[model samples]
Target: MSAPDAGGESTRDREPVLRVRGLRKAYGERLVLDDVDLDVHAGDVVCLIGSSGSGKSTLLRCLDLLEPVDDGTIHLDGVEITDPAVDERAVRRRIGMVFQAYNLFPHLTVLENCTLAPRHAHGVRRREARDRALGLLERFGLAGHADQHPDRLSGGQQQRAAVVRALCTRPELLLLDEITAALDPELVGEVLDIVRDLAAGGTTMVLATHEMSFAREVATTVCFLEGGRILEQGPPARMFSDPTHERTRSFLKRVLAP
Candidate 1:
């Protein structure tokens, strides 16, 4: 089946930016992801939402090739990335990932942190990498903190820097795993704002987020997972306001409760 574009229109002619089928992952004896299927088009912002341990983070990790799936296929731009013969490192260059924790290097300056992968992995010249890194950092309101170490910045700044670092690779797909989950309540908005901008700028993204309101506001499609399965998925307005499944409705009631 063809994927839907960011506008939710079917785009069968153009290849999907990402595709997953029968994705299953297990840790020890526990199955973390079960028979998951998903497709993301060139400009879609697909948000995966559910309670903790519902496989949101694991799914994102699988997409980024960070976690090896026990069984499934992951195709990026029509190439099956899960094949053993595929170069995992090369595949990663085209896919970016950010975790809940700000995993910036403490010793590296923010600029250095941002340029490291582009310079080392992609072989981007030092000057070119620095230029692009600074541009993204400035665009995201972190220009002033470029030379500062991550420890010097607030949680929000560090996460924003992480996003910039990911963008430096110019990845075709970005996987964001609860990027705002670690911030203080007051600081969460700043990080969400960066994601909003990325969505607006047409960056194809799949993110696992617990922020229901943010998902409703920015998601091209909302997927509600339960016990590692996608129990329901649709446009955000329908998923939030008029969910067809009782499970979805019940989950929303608790999450959106005042």
Candidate 2:
């Protein structure tokens, strides 16, 4: 699909890989997401940034169909995935999610962790799945650790393995929710480097991240979400340097201050 240029000309000819409109989610009486809307085109690395409790993770969960929304529409490749009757497992196969915690199974080896989803969910043969998993692990510098259990790998290595696991399914879209939040400060860069590589290779993604510098550096589009609403969104050059919302400026000031 055609995408808009930097000048914001119409790219309506190209449909977005993912489109969300009028999204709303709540827990009990508290609304965590309020009418959120977003569009992510193919090859776009869209980053959602905000203070804690601002619904960044909730939005990602909603998109992944992990959390049901009270109201809204989410379309993946033009299919209405939010519909109750839609095949959740099938949708998940086309969209991979990597969470803050590594979420790797304790009993599974790194290679097994990467191969399980494709092998079981999609009926891929074990050999074919293992071959693809190894290639991803090798490319991401995790080949040596493939036979190790999750407990044996460092936080950065495990997270990288999680990413490799997600990619093994060949998802059309990837959802990353604060993938570095649980890592050591020194270990964070290694995980971020994997994301940078994915962005460079044209992998479509929508990520919620607290790493301001990484968002600024790797995002094709930056969105500042506040109290579950997107207050401002634009190219990183503009969103980071010249946000129009007062709330966005205040939040950035607190986070970006030296």
Candidate 3:
């Protein structure tokens, strides 16, 4: 599939917070992402929709520098992050990622989990990290559970703590990989609510989600992927109601079937 124009005319003049071009990734002989291109401006909520194994999660991992790409150029704030000389650790400090599983340290308290990266990786003072962690926990309604371990909290609460942990770093970009995929149906809303609040507050985010209705409501831009490529992309209104590609239309029809 031909790559769609990145960000359309609305974002033409402004530099994107995240920019990707000619991105490709492969595992052995199987290519997971093929010539993918994307742009995410500051405060933009970009949703990636695709079938399993269509490379959504791998794409997120590449953006976070967790996976080394085979070929591509990825720029964060105009800096070429794909460069071999770039500091992966420093780049990671600017990008926060939350996985499907909470991935919270089992033995640590929620507050400890939230403060670890800041205190150790970012060199935040212990006291300041504690203050920032508590503040974010309070904002997300997880403050009261600060001392609890991951086992002591519900799935939703644990996920919220995970998000709060990411936010405590004040990352310029946030990547969420199927965050709701691990939650019970009844518990999904709580985690999505936190994401909604973040969107409202203008946090820059790129999320791969199966929650079609939520993506329609929350995404500034949506990209539909099939067979490891972005086949269509546009504002949610158009992408949802009228996609340019037949593959995208068919995929949406199947997923949004009533």
Candidate 4:
């Protein structure tokens, strides 16, 4: 499939890796996501940027089927994943999610944590899973710490391991929800660097982030969400330098302020 152009419009006749339409989610009286629409083509690194409570994280969760939407449809690779008969576990196998918190098993070593999902959930062979886990760990500079528990690693190391764990599944698409939110200021760069590498390697990813500068640098497309809607979306260059929406401009002003 051909990649979308800089305007976020497809350049060829190909289905997006992930497609969302008229999505709505709410918590009783509070409407969190309202009629959201998104399309992520293969190899697209789409960034969702907004302040707290802007529904960025919720949208990612909904995409992963961790939270059921009150309305709308989600399609992965042209299949309707939100269908009632679709097996969520099967869908999740093709989509990897890394959360803000490391969420590593306290009792498991880093290698064990990385191999667990692939081996158990996806039914990959134990030895194969182990080999893949070790390879990813080595690639991410975590091989030396593979035998250690999560608590023993620094915040940056733990998050890197978390990313490695997600990659171990060999997912077709990755969803990251503020993966650097829990890290110390200095540690953010290390985790973001892994994402940069992944982007360069053509990984299809959708991420909710506050790291505006990193998003501008790494994202093929940047989306600004406000009040549970995407106010503006375009190439990172245009979205960062010249947003078309007033709300988006105001947001960029505050976040980009020195």
Candidate 5:
């Protein structure tokens, strides 16, 4: 993990879009992730599920190099980038992430917030960025509110805007860490509706979430993690219907229980 070449040398024929091996993270003496491994293919939606504090968010952050790893390596399409010293800006530019808290700037209009990143990150002109933002907003039915501030929009609308902001980066990988956790149950469906469309479009996505129903339907693979370790992973039907690990079965029972 210390050296740039320390990552697993075993790569597939097509090469995964994002790969992580033996990933570990610690905050002081508290271990957040322990010996984790994952891969996201070109057109796959892999959903990582676990109880709260199971290292889902930490794993996502580590993939994007937002949080430095204590041990392990990450690669994007066979390109090693999570070595001891990685290009942080370049890595972030290739990975688009949406967090639970929208994190929109209240002072800036929705249009500005969505377009600013593209303008600064890629040197896109103001007019071009504005046009791009408008196009993305219209995809989620938010074109009419482009001029409004964050506070003026509903929770669902704000979350959709955050998704558009991340899309404006034109990233190859999209990481969503429980983006609907803070919204009302009714509002949650609206935001998820947009995500559903993206999944249908065969976007490469890695989602850490509690939306079992949505994950079951849209994800090509589902992984159940417990205590920072992936207990089981397989096709959604095999995972939900025929889980082999006791922890996975228990977790599903609890999640599926009324």
Candidate 6:
């Protein structure tokens, strides 16, 4: 990742853990993210809420450089990585992403899924990575299922393994794109509980979630994006209870309804 060639990254000598500005992406004529701006400091959980196709997931992908941005800059610890020419793997290594699907290897045991990334990305020894994997499994309440292949475990268990896999890489920032959204209603709670514990324990997270209640409980900051642009953003209390923008209020009402 190269340093930014322009201005407006507010991080000082300590460096902001993550910063994004004017992030834009599109496919032909369909604009996805229109100049999205966000900042995440150490140990903050920022929840992103939006309507379908609002580009929340795209924004997260762009941060990790999984998808090249059409315009804008993403800065991670003072490195300007928004340029399409930057080393994508270098950026991705610093930012871990947990996808909505439990993408664990069906044939691999829980322990294998957790240790794979660290061994491949960080070049960590298998013994060391396995040690860390075991610790994370225990932390996520899946230590007892270490030898079970993904198919043998419940969906909740598999998702937890995925989270542990991302954590094993020791990413400075974690992107959770609705990891529990695909689970059975009964199984969603277990995954959410693990994530709640992670946020409480000071993990830096950027979550795009439909779990508004869970977001309200765990997020330090909340953002509302609509049609590729952020409509509102503030502390959780303000964003939920006293949103200033009418569009934000309308969006929240529609999504947060019981």
TM-score top scorer = 3
**Model 4 residue 109 CA deviation in Å:** 0.5
Over 1-258, each residue of candidate 3 has an lDDT whose tens digit, in order, gives: 476844455636788999999999999999999999998999999999989999999999999999999998999999999999999999999999999998999989999999999999999999999999999999999989999998999999999999999999999999999999999999999999999999999999999999999999999999888777888888898898978888889889999997
Model 3 residue runs over 4 Å out of place are: 5-8
Model 5: per-residue Cα lDDT at residue 50? 90
* Top candidate by lDDT: 3
TM-score per prediction, in order, is 0.95, 0.96, 0.97, 0.96, 0.94, 0.92
- Reference-based lDDT, residue 121, model 2: 97
Model 3: colliding residue pairs: none
Candidate 2 lDDT trough over 10 residues, lowest sum:
1-10
lDDT for position 254 in model 1: 96
Model 6: pairs clashing at backbone N, Cα or C within 3 Å = none
How do the residues 1-258 of candidate 5 rate in per-residue lDDT, one tens digit apiece? Answer: 211211222354688898888888999998998888887789889899999999999999888888988998888989888766767898898889999999998989999999988898888999999999999999889999999999999999999999999999888999999999999999999989988999888889999999999889998888787777776777787788877777788888999998
Off by over 4 Å in 2: 1-9
TM-score of 4: 0.96
By lDDT, the candidates rank as: 3, 4, 2, 1, 5, 6
Clashes of 3: 0
Report, for every candidate in turn, its global Cα lDDT versus the true structure.
Answer: 0.91, 0.92, 0.93, 0.92, 0.87, 0.85
Instruction: Give the higher-TM-score candidate: 5 or 6.
Output: 5
- Per-residue CA lDDT of candidate 4, range 32-92, in tens? 9988888899999999999999999999999999999999999999999999999999999
Give the Å error, residue 31, model 1: 0.9
Q: Backbone clashes per model, in order?
A: 0, 2, 0, 0, 0, 0
Q: What would the TM-score be for candidate 5 when compared with the true structure? A: 0.94
lDDT of 1 by residue, 1-258 (tens): 122223345546787899899999999999999988898889989999999999999999888888999998999999999999999999999999998997999999999999999999999999999999999999999999999999999999999999999999999999999999999999999999999999999999999999999999999899989888888888898889987778889999999997
Which runs of model 6 end up more than 4 angstroms from their true locations?
A: 1-14
